[model samples]
Target: MMKKPAMQKSKQWNIKGAVHLAGIFHFLHSCGSGCLVPFLTLYFRHLGLTATMTGIIMASKHLLALVWRPISSVLARQYDKRRTVIVGSLLSSALVVLLLLLFPSAGIKAESGRCNTSQPSADPTDGSDFTTLESINIPSQSNANVYSVNHKTIITEQPDELSSTYTPTLVNSSSNWSIRAIRSLRNLEEQQEEAPHTEFLGSLKVMDAQQQMFFLVLFVIVLWEFMAAPLEWTADDGLYEYLDFVDATGRHKGVKVWKQLGAAVGTGMVGILVTKLYCRTGTVTEFYSYTALMILTAPTAALFPLYLRKRERATSGGFKALQLVYGNSQALLCAITVVLTGMATSAVSDFLLWQMQDHNAMEIHMGISLALAYLSQAGFAPLAGRLARFLKYHGWLMVLAVISLSLQCLYYSFLWGPWAVVPAQMLAGFSTGALWWSVTSQCEDIATPGTEVTLIRLFEALSLELGAGLGSLMVGFVVQKFGLKILFQGISVILALWSIALAVLKWKIPRQRRINYSRLLAADTSEVSESESDQEKDWLETAMEDARQGNKWKMDKF
Candidate 1:
């Protein structure tokens, strides 16, 4: 008996240890991710990509995640979740390093100084203004290099033997020297093309190389992002599954607290690092290197999951076909609310930094804005959990979340200064944190038994990634056409409409019934004891009858 008790105690200890380890893994992983992801757009812009291109790249990242998450889910089930996490983390880290190496750091150099004279007297027949190049001064060339100046053209002297060398063909134009004229003049002197025009040709080459490098880097980042998706699934699904095993009702709050705290510290550290490094060096290359190094350590935390014993009830085997289990009208409303919430939050995240930059916010200011957003999110996540408990109904919590999001959107739309973003971010933090936790809990409640993790992953892929990807594309186009202020205003209006719709749905739908565990347990125990007592009474009666029969037989024999 004592041994049994001791074994039970040891098992509980191990379970607690595993839960804590999972939290640690989340913290480490989140910290590494927060460093570079928030500033991805800024990094791209620094490379001279336009807003539309950057938006497309960002949207592609999420779209890839949306497409691959199902595959990742299957893989996680086929292989050990721990092993999947470790492999994914390592692969993602390696890709990050490759991305950094492939990124085009050196931009195209500016053209050398050249002379331009006023337009020469127009010919009376044509009456068109035409500029003439009087004397050209190429900063890179020495005075020893011979150049002959014609009426309006400059030609470099070349050796007689090389004069007949093949020249690139150019279109014929009678107009004064332009980019086209430069192309035409190239055919006159082949040796001079290699000598005097090297800088121009080199600049063009660099530009082409940069464009290729940009696409290559984007490809690598996308691959890294895809590899990284498994870790997120493992962390979220693992935490919920672990909590279910331990029968911990407050699982979300407990795990989220640690994760959020780590996120806060990580985001703040990133802000500080970027501020100091960018201000000092005027480049984010060092920051990327540091992020890569930090991510390499993520596998260390990931290894802890290897020690976690898989739960018997956990989803396993090849991807099982999920049965469609529809919920009530209220559930549908909640689902829509979650999707819209995701869309609104993602829009803000995708563009808030760019908006700040447009307002002339410094690098440090941008960092602070992101830091504040994350820190506030961290603080509110636990609080949101508590609020959910008090509200008791998930729909009310969803409404609260939508209201918070709308307020944040309104604030951002009218925000005129940099510091004003901090408060707006606080609202955003509360809304997102609350909405995520609420939707997750509600989904767990409505999901068929043994399908909680699968449903949650599906919901994440559909609502979060899908909504985010679409929002990114939309925000990009809206910002491109309508401008930033109008974009936020539109978001605010959409969110406001969503909130009103959710409110009406809540009013029309009845509250879901809650289960009474204590009453059910009492009834089960009563039935079991009564059945046992009846069985004992029946056995006693049979024994008495047998004894009576034996006495009657002996009397008859005598």
Candidate 2:
């Protein structure tokens, strides 16, 4: 008996160790991707890509991940999860290295001598004779060379040859010559005179080479994104597994706390590093190098979970497991809620920078707002967890999240100043933090007993990714069309409707309490089919006998 207790204690310790390891992995991964990926658009802009093109590149990653997540779920089910995680991590790290190597840090250099040096000549057809055209000397304080032209003939003079005189040969234009024709002739003369000196062959070749390199680097980054998709799903699955273990030991909140704390520290570190390294140095390569190092370290942290003795329960395999969970109406409703939550959350996240910029916020102020947003999330996550426990209804917690998110949308729509938005970000933090925790907890509750937790987590992850991808993609276009203020208003209205749908679902669907199937199966030794039929017959016979006795009693009383 003592040995059994000792083993149980050891198992608990191992489980806790695994949870901490997972948190560390989350931290490292967050530090890497979170810090740098958000700046990818800025990097592209620096490379002379337009905003529309940059948006397409960034949105493509999420769009591809949306499809990759389902495949990742299947792969996780088919393979050893530990191996899958290791492979995913290794591939992600390798991809990061490749991306850094391919990234175009040195932007295209501007070519010298490209500016047109010739001055605009007045048309002689505008009632001006050739003899009256004196050499006009426009005084420029700058050191740039200036050229003056004669109307009747092509006379070219270098800046140093300003003192040289030229006699103009008169050419009479017929009265039929239109103003357009004369203007075209003047433009042709200017082009012909400046063409030789303005064209720099070496610079042209270099710029073309840089453009090709930029596109190649972009293609590699997209490929890297495709490969990184599975890693995200595997990590979340591992987290859910850890949550299950900790919940069994009645320390689930501790897991959430550690995860949130890690995320907070990681997010804070990103702000600090970006300010210190990127802002101070202004070197893109240095930033990439730091991000690459962080990503490479994540795999090693992920390996710690494999050392834990605790193993995830085996899945039932195939679409059967998915159907079992998603077949239920309540589960379907919960999924819809999750997707809407994701849509709203992602829209706000993708647009916050733009919103701040519209309000004329400085770069430092924008950074502060983002930092506060992330910190608030980290700080409020555990508190939200406790609030959920206090309420004892995860659904209500989701409602609270929705309400908080609604308020956040409203706050962002009507911003007073940049500093004012920082305090408002706390509401966003609460909403995001609460929604994430509540959704996961609720998923566990609704998941069928004996079903693999990974499957449920996968579904949750898919909903989030799909919603976020679609939201980011669509909201970007919507903002482009309708402007930011209108976009926020539209999002606010949609969230309100989503909240109503959730409330209706909550009212209609009965809450599912977790059932211990192991204890239930162990308690019943007899064959279910044989006992069930006999019990049904006996119940019918007893009901008939009771009816007869009631009739006899009624007759005697009468």
Candidate 3:
């Protein structure tokens, strides 16, 4: 008896150690991702790509990333490879970034004199019409580089951090691309009056060499996301499996909180680092930080504990994982909501920093604002479950999330200065995290017992990549055409309509459970025709048993 008790205690210790390890690894992994992902759009913009092109690239990259995630999750659970594969993915992803850094940046011709102080002064009337560069360590641009962004007249160079996948930046290119770009556009009569109105966004011909350079760099970034895929879903799947094995499932929230907090800290650290460093080296420093953080994330992943269960893998199982298993009304509605949420997320993730730069917000301000968003994410993650339970699955929370996100997007339109981001982003967690929580609850409530992990990852990719990718395409083109403010306001209006539509659907459509076709098909009607014989009873019983056992949906009484 004493031996049995001692053995149980030792086993308990091992489980505890494993959970702690999982939490630590997640924290570090989130830290690495936070350092660069939030600012990726700004980086592309600085490279002279228009928002439209940026969105196209982002959409393609996200689509590819989506493909990788499902495969990664399947492998993690089916093959029990999450432990080693997660680490391998992280290391390989870091290597890709290292390669990205080594590839020389193209078309950025930096020269000595400040963005030609000799040019005509910009109009003072337009509050939104501030140059991307003022006096602060602005980089000189080649005319080719400036013309490559969507064709707007008010030419300006971006700050170096212009953009971390931007620390987009406080450092200016010493080059004079902005000046020549302004002059070139001014010479065109059709575009002259609209120049200041279009302001920082000016169109360059698609055939420009600078434009082509953007595609080249985008390809490399896409590859990085592909390699990073295994780290995203696979890591979470492994950790969840580990938790289930040890009966420590409740610890999942704590792990998420740690992950959010780590991201908050990492973004804030980058903000402060950008501030303390010279403008010239700010973006370079960001790349180094990004590369180093990802590298550091690798070792912790190597230590991640994944408990792979013995299971049969087949084509049917893989296909099932990808299919929608919930009711038609609710599942489809939630999927739409998730996509809308993705659009909002992608717009904010890619362009919020660009707007801040347009408003002359410092690089540090951009960093801290993003950090605050993560902090809000950490705070709300714990409360999400409670919020969902209190609402009782009516999807009221999801509607609220849509409204909140729309309001958040709308608020960006009214920002007068850099300080505006703080208030706009502080409550961001509510809109994003809440929608995700409510959508995820739908998946959890209906998921077949053993396939919960696969289902959750499937939905996650839909929201994170599919929705976001489509949103990127929309936001980028809109911003390029109408400028940032109009684009934000338009998205807000669309989301408002979406929220109202969702509310109408919820009010009209009654809650229905996922239909069990097997059970329904197996129901007997023999009693209505005649008294059952012994053979008939046995056939009915066998069919019922097979239905209960989760066999084919079609049942034959004969």
lDDT by residue for model 3 over 321-415, one digit each (tens)?
55654345776788778877887888888888888887877668888998888887667766875665566553788888899899999999889
- The TM-score between candidate 2 and the true structure equals 0.62
What are the per-residue Cα lDDT tens digits for candidate 1 across 215-267?
Answer: 76677778777767666665565556556666653544466666666666666
Q: Clashes in model 2: which pairs?
A: none
lDDT agreement with native, every candidate: 0.59, 0.56, 0.67
Candidates in order: C-alpha RMSD to true structure: 14.7, 14.4, 12.8
* Global Cα lDDT for candidate 3: 0.67
Candidate 2 C-alpha lDDT tens digits along 301-356? 54745323343454444356557557666666666777777777666766666677
Indicate the TM-score of model 1: 0.68
Q: How far is candidate 1 from the true structure (C-alpha RMSD, Å)?
A: 14.7
- Candidate 1 residues lying further than 4 Å off, grouped into runs, are 1-13, 94-101, 105-214, 236-253, 285-296, 306-325, 385-392, 513-558
Q: For model 1, give the 10-residue run with minimal summed lDDT.
A: 108-117
Model 3 off-target regions past 4 Å?
A: 1-13, 76-80, 102-207, 308-326, 385-394, 513-558
- lDDT ranking, best first: 3, 1, 2
* Winning model by lDDT: 3
How well does candidate 3 match the true structure, expressed as C-alpha RMSD? 12.8
